[model samples]
Target: MLEGRSCLIPRPPLSSSGDQESTCFYMRYGIIKEGSEEEEEDEEKIDDRGKRRKSQDLVIASSSREIQIEQTPHERNDYSSVEDLIAPIGRDISINCLLSCSRSDYGSIASLNRSFRSLIRSGEIYKLRRRMGIAEHWVYFSCNVLEWEAYDPYRQRWIALPRMPPNECFMCSDKESLAVGTELLVFGKEVTSHIVLRYSMLTNSWSPGKEMNSPRCLFGSASLGEKAIVAGGTDARGNILSSAELYNSELQTWETLPSMNRPRKMCSGVFMDGKYYVIGGMASSTEVLTCGEEYDPIRGVWRLIANMSSGLKCASGAPPLVAVVNNKLYAADYASKEVREYDKVNNSWITLGRLPERHVSVNGWGVAFRACGERLMVIGGPRGLGGGMIELNSWIPDKNPPLWIMIASKHSGSFVYNCAVMSC
Candidate 1:
């Protein structure tokens, strides 16, 4: 396993000679900027429980940080890197065409050289890749009942990952997954305690990440670029946790965050409008909670939001998967059989559309719903009735009279636990 480094990715440097090749790279891809002062050091406020907040990750996923590693064109003349390979194709069109490769090919490309590895790991690649209109997004799914698999929506194929690590008495379904930097993080209880496993796209291998401070099941989680937040789940003793924590992807560290006002489990989390919102869950195994809370990482505080009176009121009773797009929050309410968008300004929910029809669609447990690029997708099947096939359906809200499109389907022995998207 590769060790974590500074979360910041170094910007490519132009040769001092101002060579034609270097200038071409500059013309196609401009320099990326640093974060503003407010984003860097906004308000170092204390949490409700009186604890200081940790520093935000590099640039909260959109930008890099100050720790620079100079990779001038002349400095890399001796070794061939992905930059070198693409340097000749300085123009945007050819670079994007090369970038539109299969997801399974990234690991080999990254291993070509130091330059290729560094370029593949940087956020700049993602920005450039998207701008060129050649960015391809792949979805990783953990059935929780078996092993992990990734789907290339563009190619309509399934790629198997390494079997889920060490599963004697462990089942990973009650888990949460997110993409922080280039790794896929899967966290949840493994038999007795909460464990985390990190999957590297560059290495195409699985390794253990930092374990959770508290062992939890049915917790809320969301990604913040280079870092991620997970809150409110049931502990080993079946106690709902008010406790929350943050994961520093670069340091591979887990730090405790301020606990919530009330204990909750099986909650849904969505990062929207610069804050993290955790929705409806259960305080105990049997008691369902109607309230929700939003946390501002900048102010380091949590404010209570409106109570959830809509469908999927209980966490365990429904899947309660939440996602964000266009600065709005949308969730899959399995109980209602409809996906709803939450309007923070109006404090109301307007029905957006319905989930793909399934025999047992009324209940959404084991189903996974997440945002992919500009679209929202849900993956699950009505397996409860008997062994059935799984489905991947997606929606683009910008379209008039939005309709759900079934992207792919597969026969499976179990339901999905968690899902994440990577734009490579």
Candidate 2:
């Protein structure tokens, strides 16, 4: 095939006014066309689509025509601080929710910061706040060395309170112990068995109360209204005695009551309705005790109730269960761990439930009560030789088992003679 050869193209030349002319090369791909200087100046100012265009200064750019839009800041004159934003303005909000929402508030944030700083500076606020929610129980017990110990259930710990001001003689020997409100009333001393010592848990302090009519110890102490009644225990010479005495809290004095049929010591006492029960303990001999009797404070007389299946002895660390529920008396034998629930209507002892776990040495004094959370907490015995407290719990089974969680263990000097529990 025959073909013509292509030729080279020349660009337009520059003008003479000191401005160099642009090299206007008419190019189509690689093919270009030569243009004369006059031809370029004569060409009209037209776009490739044959549209007229304004001069550079008068031309409006498409991008510039677009409206300049922007988002404004959320400025609120009504709210001067974060607290204004978070605080409830007549709004019904839960305390928890309000607290959460208010945490971000300026005042709350600042206060929290200041509190943390203060706690760090004090070094005790954190610990105090941590213990604010601890569940606790207080029980009084007497040991040999440690005259008295108070067991707390929440920490499962034992705290040794102040001993009697006097450390010697029969002052340490509390033949009978009774809990009146938060104060522990003990009757019987060496000089005169009728002397009484009242220990207040709130103050963790002690004070001397009035003495009984006769010198007595190891007696059964009970309460009727504001007055305290003491039944059989022992005489001044360590003899099994059948004598009863009464102490008037209002009068701050003592009176005597009719003695029991037989002399007894370490007997279990329970006040139900308006009557007092002196359950199985022991006579003058070391033999076991099975007989039980009740006394009416109103009538000033004693009536024999149903006796326990097993005799309760003082050697058992603590006395048998003496709980009054729904105006009925219930006794628990520590030796057998068998609980006898007394039906007031039938006037008899029936088998109830067993303790989840058995306890070790009981301190003749045991404390028990129904706590807020549907649980019954029981703290027993002083720390034998070592100063400590044993605590336990009871509840309906299949749920969480009632447990005795230890809160405190310490070197309490001695285990006193009597023990009882009272709520603060």
Candidate 3:
């Protein structure tokens, strides 16, 4: 791909009489020629990496010492040369290619000029990635009171995002947060009033999201297509809610859905098998639920599914530690520190395998055990160890005798409460 090719370097004609004349300079690869005075002046505009010092491939000195130097291609002030060749492949394809580029390289690309910055900021590149079936998932977390961070799995590094909106408001928890397309919806509260804040991957900033029809906390949510579904949670009046709603990103609106069969709070929600499944939570102050309800968005109906007791058993105590792999649902058992896959065929819970031992309690507030790609990744910390350190571990269920692999370890004493994956 780096091999030599003949290219034409175009320039304005020397003599101009209110007319445009073009001159073409044909050059072979690996050959450097003395550029025009204007071209030499252009080098000053580029950064040090683009600057090429004067060097001749073959040189003769007055002392009769001949010097041979290796020369590389000179950097150009114009970026259009590459774009002209790339544009013909189609803009959508071009955008997809750009999205596939290394995330760290984005900093340099975005530094090119206003146009490059605008393209990256528009989030269109991510949209194209989704359409092309090449979207990469980034794991985002609210590690501190109001601070949040995203980890690029391919790059295996943290991506800094803008601070949470409204300054004092913090990310609520797993129950109310879900990633819808390129946006992360954080269903948090500004004091007693619940609010939704959307973090846009394209802009790297947070903005106010459409308020939910039923303002609540400790609710269940999940993303399917461009929409997010929110089910049961405690309402503003300190009452449990059965009301449900869907936030459609395309229309930028939230529409009410039929209420669940029963009121529930602090439930676990996941989109699987073409339905939004709301798992166990608190039925009332005196009772913890052992039941679940599945909603068919197309049919607009809720059906009580099997495994009410089995599903709610692990969920009732803390935030539901559930994930999906190969279209099968699984939940983390904090007592055993093992992942249990729900046997839909038999309506039972079976142990998949043990995850990595944790320094933070798996039952800690905001711990996340979610699917990233085909693997289940758990993020939590500071329980068994000191110094507020958080650790990340991942494992694939399909692997023969699944094993937990430690992927990242960061010593930050911040309370990381929730995490979700955003495909962009």
Candidate 4:
């Protein structure tokens, strides 16, 4: 069979003038042909040999049986020693084809050769995919303190991430998670200091996180593309912060942004209409702030909107349960078990419909409500026999009403400690 046969095509090396020569090698089965005007005589000589060899006669007996083909001096210049991702095809075309592949196949593709492993580990493929507006939404959530899992809604498959590094202090401390670019950052505290742990999709491994300009916990954060913004949380020494910082995943650096108008903690952040908004947080232990702040990255300004979270906040509840899909704002009201949509003009919330009947949460603490691409994802489970089940419920916002569909479920603790969505 033709499967037992292989060919290698190599282009000529660059000339002394730093220009690529036009010499090209074309190989099919066990025959090698030169692509240049000077090789016309050689081509005619091969054509004169018995109407060219038949295709079936070119098949090698076995994969280990290497066919001996004659080559010119340039073709024998050890070009195979050079690591090309996919031989015969140029690097640019190979990258384009790799970009079209599903992210789940990256592991298999990386195993092909060192060049492929480097390409996948360097995060270049994701960058190219982003430039082409190609993205897939992966829902990452942590049920146990040190365990995280990813769910692919489109593929209906679950991928368990590498176990987070063992740190007793970090495991016990309250943590926050954000997925920016291909990295998942988990923010928590060490024995006496705040620490950040990072999980990379490219390497499929966890590493120590890069420190932010201002280290804090219980902060409101959201990611858009390769950048993420964290704002208004408590810093060390139990002081509430009004500061904000922007994280660039590509550079793995954080930049200080203009502080918010007011100091607030226990808030939630979301990006809508190309702006970052912080909603429904506690200004103080006794004071619950109903105001929200909108940050315009282009203008470098934060505008305060009064009563923006009037009915969305609860005195003894967790942060506002908010998500954004298609640049539209949504919230899950744990108290009423309802879903609400934001009215941009009125700066108010409109009750859309009820949440999934079995999707239960405690004062918005245990459940995770996030935007997975074009769908709203509710991740939580109702308390049941034994431990409980973790269910992924999804719904697309429409003119009619919300209809949540149970897409996937698993047996686990009902509570979700942290969650984030990575789209790339």
Candidate 5:
């Protein structure tokens, strides 16, 4: 596991060279500039939270606070020591392409809670595998026809996994097609536009479980405790669905839960604080939505929460990234570069760190959430203002507050950043 580091600096541009290729890519903090007394004063003003506002230019410092790198490439290299020392794999390490990018957008990544000191520097291609919970040893999902691919950071090359359930089509269906708990669970498929198929991951392979009560697709599914919850999506006939169900793995049965107040599909669903949050999705109009809601299984009720600051339309649905840290829900909005942290206690949301870039599609928002020891690793996802998926970064910086870092991905035009941080 990557241990936490202390010194902080603004997120660096992800391009091969730190230099900006075009105005399209902007830095949250740029150079402090020369002889701007007023600009320096403007930087000191505190906003509502008393935190200093973003400055057009910022200085980069080493942990010792002595070495400062201000818009200089060679000087920037000096700071790499601290970053390289703590990274899971050195910045230049190649990785294996476990699966193709088409099948599974959110390729699975986990920390061993142990670091590979000897091999990391040896430059040998090796896979550092971690054991997930009891049942799920590996999990990968793709909604596209092509196989899923991922960079094996240790190997420093790309690799692709086998096609999912040959002849069985996952891309065509809408049911909650994601892995949760210890295994990847495929709940239902939009078969015949009315019927749905049920499947679950067992021993690295997917097999049919049982058919769902109804056929639906493009919905949200999450695993909390022993129950896998499937919620809101469009049915086979192309009608939006508000209904939800719980699949009890122990009993191999599906039981209907209280449906959502509104019919929706593509909403983000994550299990946090013993409850599930289904947020931001398309409505009947097929337009993006900002409404948010929470479901408590124990209470057997659903309660509406504060709406998102802005609407998230279908062009960009919330692709997971909804994680719980210290009991708060934090997620990156696909439509917006902002990563919002939800306050369950206060029933509100606070903006965390900005993504540095906003993803525009389901594939672009495919960033997976990971934690190496104490350092948070947000891998893959797209880049730029236009939504181009690229594998990037494994570390999030802290001094800037929300811990944001950018790294490149192995898959072309596909990026991943999952909020489901799990323990193996």
Candidate 6:
């Protein structure tokens, strides 16, 4: 009934010894005038008087008699309107309120206005969210080569990502994925050399990843916050390596780190108890390693832990499938289809329970075991189905044994080539 008129939503006046004026934000539609014919018609259409009162309560006339209609220059052609993110409420306060919003709503929020779109795309909001300890974990995985998808467990929704740029050589090659901050890095070999592909949630696009100082494949890698550590993998020459590197997603750069005491390949990395651990790898083609190394970022040193992964590895199996949740290390024993938890006191593993019966893996390949927030997620599907189906099962660790529950499933290739969990 108040169409085409601007309405003011006032903020409560601050209580102070000195007089403090209150501010209000403008809404595109104004309130219905009291005693107007439109109000009477609207009241009759709405049966609940409380509902009508609540609707009218949202708008308030200001005493200061100052009104503002904020507008910013249209820097880009795609923007429909160049208004302040939330006019009258300053940018800082507006961002603070936005920070508390669910990340799943970001796509819709970005579409609301030009300033919001810019803020979300600039990646500044995520950085601030990290600082404020607001994080949402989303699973990113690949079933078919060059195709990736993201699952938001909280919202129970799947987000399809842009297909990776096509390259026959890279498609057939072995690949590794790590999700750090707002970026997901996929490492693989082209016909002639190693290559890294990065997917960004902010831009919702893929681009060439920054190459490492020493490019290697089949490395042990894990991410904590905005940085990730990659260590102990074979070089391009297929020689096992002890060299390591650290990557900062914000700066999009990699720094060479001190090498481990031993060279290994096909190892798994995890962040536990505020440190990075490289567990269960092969020193050579014939020698399997049970020892794990712990890297202390504060001390800038790697401490070797003997027999740390003694019983976790299998003969000729993929590197120990491991994940860390709530600073506790856990491993998925694919051969036995069981889960084990690490005891830091004794440096041993305790059998927790079995993985989901439907979860299938071949020598630890094709399946993904990852820590999603506080839950352990197992991603895979049964073997030999005419049309494949991927299932996502998760269990929260507790005193009671793990109770695997199906979070979601979809018709896709049963084999999961690479997977990573990004929390920001």
lDDT of each: 0.61, 0.46, 0.63, 0.77, 0.45, 0.77
The C-alpha stretches of model 2 lying farther than 4 A from their native spots are: 1-138, 142-160, 170-175, 191-195, 200-204, 306-309, 314-319, 345-347, 356-358, 362-376, 381-389, 392-416
**CA lDDT for candidate 4:** 0.77
Q: What's the CA error at residue 99 for candidate 4, in Å?
A: 1.4
Better of 1 and 3 by TM-score: 3
User: How many clashes (backbone atoms < 3 Å, residues ≥3 apart in a chain or on different chains) does model 5 have?
Assistant: 50
Number of backbone-clashing residue pairs for each candidate, in the order shown: 1, 25, 7, 0, 50, 0
Cα RMSDs, all models = 15.7, 34.3, 14.1, 13.9, 18.8, 13.0
On residues 1-424, what C-alpha lDDT tens digit does candidate 3 reach at each position? 0011111112232121111111111111001122545434433454344455443252212122333434333422333343421233434444444555544355455444344545665555555545545545668887776667676555456655666755445533333567887678877656567677887655555788878777888888888657889898887677899999998875778889999998988788988888988988888775777778999988999999755446434433675678776688988877677778887878788776775665446353546788876678888773556546766777768746558776766655445667888754
Candidate 1: global Cα-lDDT?
0.61
Candidate 4 structure quality by residue, lDDT tens digits, 1-424: 1121011112242121121111121111111222444344544554445244332122112223534334333332232332545444447656766765666567655543345656777788889878777788888999887988887665456777767888886667789999999999999866557888898777666899899988999889999889999999998777899999999999999999999999999999999999999997998887899999999999999999998888777878889999998889999988898999999998889999999888667788889999987789899866554446788888889997898877778776789999999988
Mind sharing the TM-score for model 6?
0.81
Stretches off by above 4 angstroms in model 4 are: 1-83
State the lDDT at 243 in candidate 5: 92
Model 5 C-alpha RMSD to native: 18.8
C-alpha positional error of residue 186 in candidate 2 after TM-score superposition, expressed in Å: 3.1
Question: Top model by lDDT, which number?
Answer: 6
Off by over 4 Å in 1: 1-108, 111-136, 190-192, 359-362, 382-388
Worst 10 residues of 4 by lDDT: 21-30
Residue 109 of candidate 6: its Cα lDDT? 65
State, as a TM-score between 0 and 1, how close model 5 is to the true structure.
0.54
* Residue-level lDDT for 164 in candidate 5: 49
lDDT for each residue of candidate 2 in 193-259, tens digit (9 for 90 to 100):
3566777432345788666667666666655334567777777777876777776654567787787
lDDT by residue for model 5 (288-363), tens:
6677778998898988765642443444444344544434556655556566666556656676666644333453
Task: Give me the runs in candidate 5 sitting further than 4 Å from their true place.
Answer: 1-146, 149-162, 171-176, 187-191, 194-202, 286-288, 308-321, 356-400, 405-424
